[model samples]
Target: MATVRGEDIVNTARTALGVDYVWGGNSLTSGVDCSGLVQQVYARYGISLPRTTYNQINIGASVSPNKLRPGDLVFFDTDRKKSGPDHVGIYMGGGKFIHAPRPGASVKISSLAEGYYMDRWLGGRRVSGVSADPSSGGGYAEEVAPRLDAHELAETYGMSYAFFKSQPELWKLLNGAVSAQWTPERFQAAVKNTSWWKNNSDSVRQSQVLAKTDPATHKATMEAARVAARQLAVKMGAILSEKNVDQLAKNMVHLNWQEAQVQNYLGAYVKFSSDHVLGGMAGAAAKAIKAEAYRNGVAVTEQSVLNNAQYLVRGLTTMEQVQASIRQQSAGLYPAFAEQIKAGASIQELASPYIQVVAQELGVPDTDVDVYSPKVKAAMTRANAQGQPEAMNLGDFTQMVRNDPAWRKQPGVADKTLNVGRQVLADMGLGF
Candidate 1:
């Protein structure tokens, strides 16, 4: 087994300083909720982690809080039910740990001595060598395998060429399976076995319907289906194009229902496109059907498209669900990403807003901007201290920010803007 140094782990955790917290999100960008932060940090150092705090606690040998060191995970049961661990943070040594606190909090360091955290503390686990290597078959090695491949399969089944091309693993898997000597039933069964495919099972059934239907009757059925689908599409598109978040939130329920219908249509369309055995159907009909199907498919499942819309709607709904105290406290807390997007700020300025916004929204002031900034600096500093050849520098930070979602959607933000921001930050001594 190999060891990841304490300083290296701290540095890795620091890089995630301002990432937003999404309940089940673990990615560095879109935002990582609590358990996600810990999972992502350790993963960067080749350490495998469970997706939830409770499961994560069992990852490595248990260590008493007194014996905790940097990179160790600190577990807590905030709910007080004692049912299971509900919150987690990374031990950054010297009685401090880094964590994504809650809805209104960003990733920040907090003292282990704090009464709140100390009372809920469920002890710590050292994950340094938990999963050294999957090929070598270590304790946690299997957990390290990428799960995004499932998403790839979903995107492929959805007939998203752009997503499939971006995710080669999924493309290869599907392409390989398609090329293999399997009947349509076998292929459909294999796809259904995946989590992604299971979520979109409606699409599968719709596809099967299209595949098995008679061509002559299909034309009439198809016309009726198109009319129904287009009406839903028009409604969803109208809601999505609105600028007001409140109206958007209100429209989401309707949109979600419409999305499901579009997904069904997409599935039917993809199956039709790939297995167009009906030689008698005119090319024009084929083309129209295919176009409608692809449009509906993307409308229902593109990562950035549907997910983003869902997120915005959900966030607003959640905000409205909470009490006035939580909402007011949340408003004061400084939205990590939203603040950066106010009025006219460049997207570069908004990078890392996810973590920042979560911290602020959660009303966890102890883990607010003032506390977060130094943690990031310290993480960067420690990375440099470790003498690791690949320690992230200004260039890395700039690249990270530019690639971050905060910058990805801004009005005038482009690759060129990112390069300029990198240059500017470097000149300002913040780069590297």
Candidate 2:
């Protein structure tokens, strides 16, 4: 999962606190309903959400209240007399959620543990970032695994092998399922109306962790995301007038786009326009890439977002792209990755100082985890031909290198190797 900052989402929503409530309104500054307020805040991040409370709750994966994080959508039966979920808010952690609390009230943050909401709490949802999935009119590509490949990992991550094998399209549902907390029955019922959800790669697989994006383009776009979003919305057939587009463009990008009059005749102006420009589905893939960068918790730039869009356009997912980028940089480790894999080592095992040095030496953007699996497989084949057994993991290889007294004296080798060793030692969290 990508590391989305709930703090960021909460802070954006925080900007709208005290705005007047308007029925069916979707604006924060002028006025907005409960769902509108939540929808608008998330839209700024390029996440598309349903306008209505009922639809919003039904779409994403569910989370137990105990696991609630910032940015989660919290549902409620505001009237206590109403049937089903009638109101919603964005959870801001610390037992609080922000919303436009009906007429005569302003947008404000309230507690989930409050008496009125606690009694009527319907549930919470975690939106799955499947923005470019085929079900949502996607244009990106992905590979299909054989029906037989719906094995234990598939089940472990989510879904039962027996069910997906019996129903090929069920794998497609898995993409939406595990990411959020949507139940199988609910997902099935909802997808029944959409033919796209049934069309999935034979077995669902994450393609790649994409390369770091081109920062220049990313900066250019994010700085102008609002204008670009409006223009693209017009291109995609949303009913934004040139005047509306210009007015929208004039404001800061973070303005309430969830406002109905501001964005569309029906609801907030085209919510997913930021992603649509990249590719129908490429946007979510782009978010996934940034999410990984956030998880890596290292240097992040506009390039990370750009790289996400670039690779997703070609059907590579975030992790797959990251691997590809590493391979491009790991030319030195083609031999090392091969040796490690030949010894039947796991990819996790290959994330070592050895891979780190090759990355530095090649001047490629890489973390310890970018060792390519394909080169490892090919190298394994060669090693087996030479009668080598699966004998050395990356750790063992590093130890062997450490033990060799002459390895320290080898010209052009010692500096690079020692630097990596020091760096690895400094990364206290990762176990060799």
Candidate 3:
């Protein structure tokens, strides 16, 4: 599951390959600035992250570059004038990251070994709520300590914590559940199954410790189980109050039912208990399941669920197996593509493969092919030809736009200014 989630992050980044870099832009089709791309990709997984590069650096726990993981946010102080973070990129593991470099440069993978980047590297920040389990060791640790006081815990964890803590009976029941001998993996899976557990890292750690201490403590085991169950109940209650039970049921088509199958049963429970008969206890659990189902999507049957689950699990495994293959293909090709663009390849020639790869990956029609219209091309060409002697590159064409009076004043005289006036008359495109 961890591997699958990581691959999803990488795939999402890959889908944005070749998108033109635009300052302060975020959307894929329109354009994306550096931070915007990272923000949108994480948002797809229900993780709420800050939008700005500066804010992003401060949100999650800090980690050293050596300890950096695939989804970690790596920051840079691009301008020495800035006191802190000025730019950011999503670490794609193996000493590479995807970022929008600058104007005239599209989204691309860059090496950390580059001297320019090494000098500006500021460190990394991990996103919160992404679990710190040893099995999923890459996630950042929780910076804030857990609240011990029930009232404080209630506030810290939100209403779900309040609901469970208010019922001492339920709390004791759950404490017992955690004390039982369950496989560490199974215990962690159960913790994630509940929405409350998903956000409470401290609680998860405590439960895991309790479960590992002694196998003979039935009361401890039962208490832990009850807490988990009550947490689930509170989540369901919240969903029921929102009147989204039906919608939750509809979302159950994506889960692997054979593994846990909790969504189907929870969907039925929500349908049966609309009146809040169980002191609104069942409502919260139902709502929690509905919320998870909505985010993760649900599967219809056991087989379908298993197949989907296997697909994700195996997809991640396959990705690792073929990493060399993908990198080999990409490394040889991407640099050549970059070289071609720099060597005066037409925009069509330069952008066609990039557009096709990105379009196919993102499931969007290829629109990048038409991004540079013929009119724009002609204008650029005329500007280039006119400014050839005085201007050498795209920057020269830009300067010509600013300085050439005839090119600017005559509207369509770009060709005449360069070909007839400058080249023929031995006059520089710049009048001065």
Candidate 4:
């Protein structure tokens, strides 16, 4: 879709980002119909749209799908069982459109580039005073069109249009994410809630923003995440063949993951597999894990994938360490090794910080311990890595790592805390 330089219609449409879909309803908070949603939002800026899908589709000059811009109204022949512009939504560029889907559903955002909408797409119409095509006489749309589409969209969400627009980079991000059909609320929540956005340096925040929003960047990172999660799943799955891959798929459904989110979470679940781990573990564990990680300041950036990879390596090494040390180290070494661990590190630090320090001191190969690829490791230190992995200074998983081995073995602080309760856990030997 084309980018226009003036007031963005997407701006106003956002005010209703997550409203419920109430047939015939027109309130943004209470809900609205597809056309009601369109008309009400546009009306806020005084742009009139006939309060029905048929009339709304006729409000502006026709725009070809390929040439559609942000404020254009896209019509769909939804209910293919039916015909002709039965559905209407605002195109938000990058192949996404925003609208209130049908009953029992909320006024959520969705994509026009794919899914049912792609097949149903009828056409688009540019309202909100976007310039008419140069071929259409190089004039603007009627003065009656919404005067402040972009500004209104930002205002509805409690942000300044000037501040939002001034950051071309952020707009680029919003364009990519919204175009990808990410809800504005999710995008906003990510910004306000994620540590990478809240506490990072300005440059790091921009990089994190780009990594999360840019389709190409997010795609690549997600691909790696999928691979990592899958590898973890498979490796752990192999240990419990009875549990099977189908279990993973079921876990996804039961968790209510979107069609797009299943694979990524499947990857994460695989990364976290254990005999005691259930498919159910994924749903509860993910939020808790992410929340804990966030609280501890783990920056889930492009580097975070590496950090996960590092975690995979660390877990592998810990197993290797246990096996090797079991055979060679004297009984006393177990207690001695446990003594060196410092308590209260965050989970991020656990991957390498807690382990590697001791592993290196204990003569673990740099090969076995420093898992980050040299290039990724280097990029991490740079304030600007062009969206590549940066130093994951976001948060640390250190203390968690330090506490674990202590709980499992030797006379450490966590040992006295009654892990004594796990004998049945030991007895079952159940797994992922």
Candidate 2 structure lDDT: 0.55
lDDT of 2 by residue, 338-368 (tens): 5443444434344444455434444334563
Off by over 4 Å in 3: 1-4, 131-432
TM-score of each: 0.30, 0.30, 0.31, 0.31
* Preferred candidate (lDDT higher): 2 or 4: 2
Q: Pick the candidate with the highest TM-score.
A: 4
Error of 1 at 46 (Å): 2.0
Q: Model 1: per-residue lDDT, tens digit, 1-432?
A: 576666677778888888777777878766888889877877787777778877887887888865666667888889975688999888776667888888866778776655467567787887745322234444332122122233333332334334434435445656665455343335446756756546544644443334333444545554554455544433333222223333322233223335543433322222112343211112222333333323211112233223323322223322222222232332233233223333433222332343353333333343444313543333232324455322234445445545546555656557757788899999989976
**Ten residues in sequence with the least summed lDDT for candidate 2:** 203-212
Q: What's the C-alpha lDDT at position 237 in model 1?
A: 32
Better of 3 and 4 by TM-score: 4
Write the residue-wise lDDT of candidate 4 on 1-432 in tens digits: 343432356777787888889989989888898999888877776576798997877776887766766677889897767666898987776556789999888877776534356556688887645543233665553322222244333333344455455556545555555455454445565446544346555544443434433547645644554454455455433222324444543343233335345434334333333443323333333344444444233334434333333333334333333222322322122222222222333322333453454343334454454323232233233333564322344233233333445334534545534454465566689433
Model 1 CA deviation exceeding 4 Å by range? 128-432
Give the range where candidate 4 is weakest over 10 consecutive residues by summed lDDT. 330-339
Per-model tally of clashing residue pairs: 22, 24, 43, 28
Candidate 3 C-alpha lDDT tens digits along 374-431:
3223332342344442212444434433453433554444564566665545554454
